[model samples]
Target: MDQDQQWLINCLNASLDPNHQVRNFAETSLQQASLQQGYGLALARVAANRELPFGIRQLAAVLLKQYIRKHWNEDEEGFEHPIVPSNEKVSIKGILLASLDDPYKKICTAISVAVSTIAHYDWPDDWPELVPFLLSLINDQAKLNAVHGALRCLALLSSDMDDMMVPKIVPALFPCLYTIVSSPQIYDKSLRCKSLSIVYNCSSMLGVMSGVYKTETTALLLPLLQPWMEQFSSILK
Candidate 1:
């Protein structure tokens, strides 16, 4: 590792130290470091590194999520957080999704939250490829952790998607969700539950959309309704 990365790892370790002074000092140093270019990407790398201690990795993941929230959008009206450099944002976004496959559940959850936060501001417009990229991961049965990570992100995003986004994502997302929820032998119960939750959230969004975009919403949901109902029945049983 480079000197900067090593120093970051040290700060992450110190932040978790029981000593108040040491932890405070480390946090101050980290806050200052957040202004530097590549800081977010560094935290991402540290979080994804399996060689690091679990606590350190988890802290890095959590900090990275906060970093994205604070610095991502420069144009938001009232936010005072400094804008993350555009080049750094591109670099960070590129690798951020891959970190979803981290074996540690906490790390994966943190990365998923980070992805959802980024998607909130960037999806479809700035991040045109987000849904397709996530769909690829969800469909990749070879990597269960990636699938879990993708599902976590989708679950979070589903709850808050607007009408335009609902139609764009639901048709693609429901089929994949159905695949996971229906295959009890292939997916764990928790993953199936998560898929069901996304379904619920998406269905709620569709219910709201039905009033305004009735024809489009109906066409989007019609084919999948029966199969989804069957799966829901199976789960209830």
Candidate 2:
């Protein structure tokens, strides 16, 4: 309702317009270096507003990601250190997660990128619960986007965390991956691919595959992977 928010929403909305010139103008305006902080907050508001057009909200999410990568923690250590304070950070996170479930799926990519960006700075410590929250989404029986978004985010974080964290994290992750990759009832090829990608990334970490080689983990893994062994064996030739 306020004039400032309305302007931000309008700019984001304009970015979604089909006309080339209008879209270009709105895109340029939102990226102005001098006004990034205000613009970023405004866009975060629009991104979180479920009532808005999904395209506009997607635009907001993308723009907010840019702000988060560049400006989120670019300040001194203290209560007001980060350019975006703790309270606002929490609010932005809530919005991004909600958008992950956006029925349209239009905003999934932006939200996933934003989450990965956050995970880079705050994981295993600052955000100990982050992995669990994303895991719940992957395990949820409903909503395809939740699984898709969660898988995308986990893979991104997997790249940053090597074996020290992987051993601890992989146990929780593989069970959900088992459900998706092995069970056809809820199976999705794209989800399966992302799940395997997570496995592959974990294996890349120094000691991660050694942990996976254990008897208990091997038992859980074989059933899910064995059914595909014939196909894999043929491919190996």
Candidate 3:
């Protein structure tokens, strides 16, 4: 490991220390580190390092999520934190998605939250490949960990998506969600439920979009409507 990464691991370990002063000092140092250019990448590396103690890895993932939320975007109203540098943004985005397949559920959840937060600012426009990348993961049923991570992030993103985003996401996503939700033999209950939640949010967005973009939205929804309705009825039963 690089010196900075090792130091970061030490700090993450210290942050969990029972000693109040040690923990506080480590947290303060981490907060300062968050201002630096490579801090997010380092945290991501630490979080994804399977050899590290699970607690430290979990803490790193949590801190990484917090870092993305606080500093990823520079233009939000009242934002004051230093923006993540462009090069570092590219590197961070590249590594962030893979960590979703982390064996630790807590770490996966934290990374999913981080990915969703980044998507809020960068998806489609800055990060055009994200939807397709996530869709690929969701479609790959052989990798359940990746599928779960993708679904979790999509569920969060779908909840807050804009109408413009709906058209891009709904067509590709609805089919995967339906497949998972409808096939009890293939996906377990939790995966089915998460997929269903994303479907609900995407459907809600589709409803909102139909009001103004009737022709386009109808075209998008026409193929998926019957299957979704059937699944909905099954769930209600």
TM-score of each: 0.95, 0.77, 0.94
Candidate 1 residue lDDT tens string, 169-203: 87788899889989988999899999989989988
Q: Candidate 3 lDDT, tens digit per residue, 1-237?
A: 879998999998998999999999999999888888799889888888889998998888888878887788878664557888899888888888888788777788888888888888898799999989999998998888998899899989999899878888787788888889988898999999999888878888888878888898888889889988888898899
For 150-172, candidate 2 gives per-residue lDDT tens digits of 88888888888865687678667
Compared with the true structure, the alpha-carbon lDDT of candidate 3 equals 0.86
Candidate 2: regions farther than 4 A off: 15-29, 32-41, 75-82, 206-237
Predicted structure 1: lDDT: 0.87
Error of 3 at 88 (Å): 0.9
Report every candidate's CA lDDT. Answer: 0.87, 0.72, 0.86
Task: Mark the regions of model 3 whose C-alpha exceeds 4 Å error after superposition.
Answer: none
Q: What's the lDDT for residue 60 in model 1?
A: 87
Q: Give the TM-score of candidate 1.
A: 0.95
Clashes of each: 0, 0, 0
| Decreasing TM-score order of the candidates | 1, 3, 2
